[model samples]
Target: MNNPYNVLCIGVNHVPVRRLSKLDYAEKDAKTVAKYFDTLKDKAHVTLLTGENATRTNVLNWVKQCSNIQGKLTVIIFFAGHGSAEKDENNKKLERCLWINSNLDTGPGSHQLKTSEILNLLNNPLHQLIFLIDACYNFDPKQEVSIQDIFKQFKESERMTGLKQYAIISASAVNQGALEDPQLGHGVLTYYFLQTMAGKYTFFLRRKISFFRFLAVLDKRVRNHRFLTDT
Candidate 1:
């Protein structure tokens, strides 16, 4: 496949000593993504950031630099780490956030990378942009925002042009936990997504896979796993 794109893979396995629990396989997840993309050397430029290096500032800087690229560009960002959803005080809706290295501090002003920040940084003049978030989200019943809804809002926002193609895929649905499998040595969603991308578990569809088709296969594969029932 002639995949012309630039890939940024960020994986966070541990926070600073002050924060919560550690993600045992997040670094592995990032490495796996980088390795997979490495095979597409003919069609892509891949950058991998893991552990302490995957800080908010570094990520933001890279995104800004990529936005300045001259010609047609497709940027794919894959984040594997902790994610949370908090109630938006004004809208009374759940807003998603990604825990970066700096978010480890429990101080009064500590901040994680929220959906809005990401949307702003990535809303550049790129041909296509894709986000794959593999993290557990604290879904609230009162105002849970679906993955589609989040991206839709970005499309409608004044900062972004409606013509740009964008896609955001989450590992799990609202109020669900994105579980990792010891057997597979990876997050269940990531495992399936890679498999589908590599054409491992396709349902005999020999044709080229579309983005939505890949999502459908990934969702089905994840739903069928018996051990991943823990939310």
Candidate 2:
């Protein structure tokens, strides 16, 4: 089969209306990341959409438009910021992830969109869809949240019928929060991802490395950082 003929990358830095607005930062960072994937544009169609101002509607539209893409299609979504999660009643085993937003209510029927929503959106016919979330999911200071738990939940969903082949890489573990380096001025996971792809840590992994290994190496590298914190 031919390689993927299209690519979509979405990145966000700030939650809409919540915390500090970092849409500008996310837009700038997305542009740089888009550059890294520019070589693919010549061989395959690529669409890079990003911003702190990016809403669930924007994401939904992107997913709707890309689902019908012919041939192999690679969809990448990168998120950077704070996130939270809670138990879901309808889906007892699954937890609902909440993206931080200014008007998000902590009570029942809050406004944050669920991960299932995003998953359902990309559950199309793409050859491959990669999800990279660089943010904290549980924000309760008294309690710790497990990033692994959330990831495991998603992993289990793949067993269901009709979902595309997927790979997920998070900035930290279930109980950990992504660290931001004052010196580097970016999330630790983002830094390591860039470094590995830039020939720093992957130098010894042979010339051609698979996406899984790249994420594994990057995960370990981020975990080993000195300023690790639980979010």
Model 2 segments more than 4 A misplaced: 1-6, 16-28, 92-111, 139-164, 200-207, 226-231
Which pairs in model 2 have colliding backbones?
Answer: 4-72, 17-102, 18-102, 23-52, 84-137, 145-174, 146-174, 146-175, 147-174, 148-174
Question: Which tens-of-lDDT digit does each residue in 1-231 have in candidate 1?
Answer: 124678889898776534448878888998998888887587778889898788878888778777767667777888898876655657755566777777345653254777667667665564577778888766445555676655544333221122346767777544456777788899876787778877844421233755566667776777787344644
Model 2 scores worst on lDDT over the 10 consecutive residues at 155-164
How does residue 228 of candidate 1 score in lDDT?
44
Every candidate's lDDT: 0.69, 0.56
Would you give me the overall lDDT of model 1?
Answer: 0.69
Q: What's the CA RMSD of model 2 in angstroms?
A: 5.9
- Root-mean-square deviation per candidate: 5.9, 5.9
Q: How many steric overlaps does candidate 2 have?
A: 10
